[model samples]
Target: MSLHELRLLPWTTPEGNPCYLSADSDHSALSRLADDLEAAQLDSGAQVLAGARAVLADPGAGERAVRFALTRAVESLDDALRVAVSRGRRIPARHR
Candidate 1:
């Protein structure tokens, strides 16, 4: 689901990790689904938002979509960190 459809309150933790609170704990499956979504290769903020919106709108949707969204989020964050490190030449100098 797009962030808008999911009504996600986007905020970062002290460590700069994006996180959200899900009140719909009745379905334990949603938790894992969220994790899977965070692991996907959603390389752009816009795509993540769009995908999240689509998932959140379908109340009857399977947990897979949630998983996909979570995957994307995580992948995006990982990409960001890699970029930051690369820009600073933090990796072994020889690797560059």
Candidate 2:
């Protein structure tokens, strides 16, 4: 089946392994939850980018402070990536 026909729900197993559920409808409870989580992650990434920019522009910002901001930004980026992968469609590459 085409990836667009499926909705991927992100979840974690008890052992912390990444897990996903594929459903036909986007209105399922798990799909709705995934959508909410994705929105939160995207918002967090945007906020972190703003904060990191501010920190970088401040001459008084110490190395530790910059590093901390970068770390958080990386985490936010990771979450955003997870959310994107969960909902994104895979396009087939054309033959050369």
TM-score, every prediction: 0.36, 0.75
Model 2 TM: 0.75
> Residue by residue across 25-75, what tens digits does model 1's lDDT show?
423575455434433333475577677778888897788888888787676
Q: Model 2, which residues run further than 4 Å from truth? A: 1-16, 90-96
Worst 10 residues of 1 by lDDT: 1-10
| Candidate 1 regions with alpha-carbon error over 4 angstroms | 1-45, 88-96
Candidate No. with top TM-score: 2
lDDT of 1 at 40: 39
On lDDT, the leading prediction is 2
| Deviation of model 2 at 70, angstroms | 0.7
Scored by lDDT, model 1 comes in at: 0.54
